[model samples]
Target: MQITRAQRSAVAERITQLERSFYGRGPSNVKVSVSQDVPVSLVVLSIDSLTAADSVLSARGHREAVIRHHEALHDVTRADFINAVEDVVGSQVHAYLAQVHPDTGHAVRVFIFADSGDSRELDSLDDRDD
Candidate 1:
């Protein structure tokens, strides 16, 4: 099983949309992809410029503090993130894994969907002509 290009784009667009509404403004770039593993649909979203402000603070020797703050911020908004992903994927979100790499000035959002419509079955209903 593989997550098609259509699925990839759909997830990416949703993430981009969330940036403005959730984070004040969209990131510089958002890359999204899906891994076709068994039993679940795993989506990985790489967000650039997500940690920019924190990175600047990190350079001032408060890296740990900034990192902790980032973690707490995400925790506070985790529910909204999960809901957004679920809406785009049209499946129940089983798990949401979020991480920020301040060293790299990037963040990752992974959404694992509880098996909803199987890939084979979703091919027909997903908004893809293929």
Candidate 2:
């Protein structure tokens, strides 16, 4: 289930592009980590806390909203595997927002798990063990 170096590089490049589009630049505190066992790449956004953003998504009754968002993007960018990774990262932002700002109702946190042979999975904030 390990992702190839080329795949990871492609995903990273797409993520960099996505960050520029969304935040006007990569997050100052954003961190990217890759796992070979799960064939997953994690884009962690450092926030002060989760209550501020977490509350929004929770209040909206959209536990898996982040995951769905990423899946949509994944489907849209059929040829670009990196797009899928960006989707997952984008989804995580929302999940993290919800987790950090529970009262704000703006969830943000995107976790992308890529399975063998180009398969990708997105998990929402609620889905996270933490």
Candidate 3:
């Protein structure tokens, strides 16, 4: 089923609320988009202005620290995020990927939904060398 704009907005709002409740702060902006692919559907959440500490740490030449902090926090709160997304999308998320940019203090969270049809097979690396 195709995701609707209202559903996307609802997902984004839920994510924002989760961030605020879990992290004590929410991003300055949040965007949610859906992409339908061959084997699965992807719901992507992009966030801007992660945190004030990100800028401070990056300015002190501890950019990696900022990234690591976000990653660790995300890991700890993974289940909460996954649950919120699943609730809004009304589908089980098979995989979740998250990343943060040290310089820009931007982050992206991708929720991969299960496929409802046969998946396309990919060629092996050896086949590509032929």
lDDT of 2 by residue, 64-110 (tens): 66345434543443323333554434422111111223333222344
Error of 2 at 125 (Å): 11
Which pairs of residues collide in model 1? none
> TM-score: which candidate is best?
3
Q: Which should have the higher lDDT, number 2 or number 3?
A: 3
Candidate 3 off by > 4 Å: 116-130
Winner on TM-score (1 vs 3): 3
**Candidate 2 lDDT for residue 36:** 42
Which pairs in model 3 have colliding backbones?
Answer: none
Candidate 2 residue 112 Cα shift, in angstroms, is 4.4
Error at 28, model 1, angstroms: 1.6
Ranking of all candidate structures by their lDDT, best first: 3, 1, 2
- Listed per candidate, the RMSD to the true structure in angstroms reads 8.8, 10.5, 7.5
How far residue 95's Cα lies from its native spot in candidate 3, in Å, is 0.5
Pairing residues by index, what is the TM-score of model 2?
0.34
Whose lDDT is higher: candidate 1's or candidate 2's?
Answer: 1
